[model samples]
Target: MRRVLKITLVSVAGAALALNTAACGGKKSSSGDSGGGDGKKSIKVGLAFDIGGRGDQSFNDSAAAGLDKVKKDLNVTTEEISAKPDEPDADKESRLRLLAGKGYKAIIGVGFAYTNAVVKVAKDFPDTKFLVVDADQCTVSGSNVEGACFSEEQGSYLVGAAAALKSKTGTIGFIGGVNTPLIQKFEAGYVAGAKAAKPGIKVLPAKYLTQPPNFDGFKNPALGNEAAKGQLDAGADVIYHAAGGAGIGVIKTVGGAGKWAIGVDSDQYNQPAVSSVKDHILTSMVKRVDTSVFDFVKAVADGSFQAGVKKYDLSNDGVSYATTGGFVDDVKAKLDQYKADIVSGKIKVPTKPGA
Candidate 1:
């Protein structure tokens, strides 16, 4: 079996780590140290974005939502390093080093592309707290670095069920950015969910790119569009995509064809761009990157940035279902039941593919 280590992107441009200290708003600190407030120390958060940046409408944008929340609630601002997977790792390391040198207390690297970067930087900057999302547990345990991962399978399962129920036709489709474990994280859960909801549901699954890990796949909509069209031509009525930017293309194609689509990460129905497809959206697998990022920032602030692998399961509201489309009411009821089952331990959806 090939172990696919799917690396995600850093984040989008709109994400910042600036703290919103209301009382300290522009008030000069008596201590003469800028950023340090009258009551709290100024905390800087660095966000290293993935290749797709903020517009991917899936993974990267979801992560940005969390960082935005932290900035609004915690009074901590952030800086971003937008790097594609194809970019040299050494260059990214230098960028991380620069942010650390500038006195950022907490640094967040959003995807697997920064897996080695975070590991290396964590070793060098023992003082800076680090957080990595969509990550595999690396060696060199540190109280400073925290891994924020999601039970994508849980959310994927709900949408999978939704896709199964809503597909006017019996066939469904799945398009992903990479062919790695992380992508599999979404794939495994979706297939299982579809099967659980509608036994013997026909599923069409395809990876956008065939390379070892095409992080760019997440940034490409054209490729996703073409792939989705192929599925639709094959009789799939509902398509679910975890392909980040590529997923956007999926939504567009589905909307253009007057078919249905399943969104991921954030609620695609709510996005202005996807407004045209709002009606066609079956449901979305809410991967709560926003909550996870906000909580991680708070952890660093409260001195609770614990090291090691910390998984976000369904029970903790880490992953959930969102369907604002026409079928939301029906989908919501079903999702609620599924949620109950998952919380009550009656359901245990596998996170890996072919499980």
Candidate 2:
């Protein structure tokens, strides 16, 4: 059965928090032909960041990384509108339209949360190329738009297994920004991973909001700590936080607890989480969002843009398991085989619950 992608379409500002900053590059656009310019097509690429803004160490950062690469490699100038967790859909949609009107050749929305906003913008601005990460194909598959989906579970499974192997307790937890298909993919893979390590491993889940559209759900570290503590109290020894900035709490809560947490999207092992937890960070499930974003920009610049769903996974080098934390060294041999199995179709990863 095909599952519909239920997404949160809007965000509003809530508590404000500070995080480190990183940016991607692009060139300014002119009234000349849309090929940027004659030489390199001096096109302006616009990116609207997800609620966590710059340093959620997850999707936003990943997208920025890709944009940074494209900006340098393709040499295009870029601009971005950083969304507050509470930024309204109307406000964001206007920004998208303005960016398009400003002669931006491509405008990228970094998360599925932008689905409601981007869909309308893409339709109105058919002349401009639009790309949205993790969007529902039923809603946003236009001739001018592209959806970049990922095999999150396939990669998350490996990291989940690594966390299980590194844990003393047979319990792990998952923290998500919202209980949507994308985050559900993370939760399901985590459960599968814990099971693969040792069947019957307990998995805990934490959701920040009681309702949907709370994109700030990813920006709350205090709630994350509370959730992590709840899991720890229940005897969870490791946690894989897919909760964006909320992950900071997981790191802070795990301090000296003799347990660990896996960071998602980026290598959180080298971040403040690791600085606080030492070697407690097991690994991160990386979605090279930045690579894909920049790839799209470069594609348009080269006049080779592909519309519709473009899947990114371990096979495409779009998504992969990163063990930069050294916590997975003991299981490298096993992981190598797992990677092979996924690549060769020997192992089938699930996209939904009970799948």
Best by lDDT: 1
Candidate 1 Cα misplacement greater than 4 A, ranges? 1-38, 137-140
User: What C-alpha lDDT do the candidate models reach, one value each?
Assistant: 0.74, 0.72
Query: Per-residue alpha-carbon lDDT of model 2 for 273-327, expressed as tens digits?
Result: 4586857777778888877787788888889998888888888877777777577
> TM-score for all predictions?
0.86, 0.85
| Stretches of candidate 2 exceeding 4 Å from the true structure | 1-38, 137-139, 205-210
lDDT tens digits, residue span 19-99, model 1: 222321221111112334557656888777777666567777887788666665665656655564566777568667877
Per-residue lDDT value at 341 in model 2 = 88
The lDDT of model 1 is 0.74
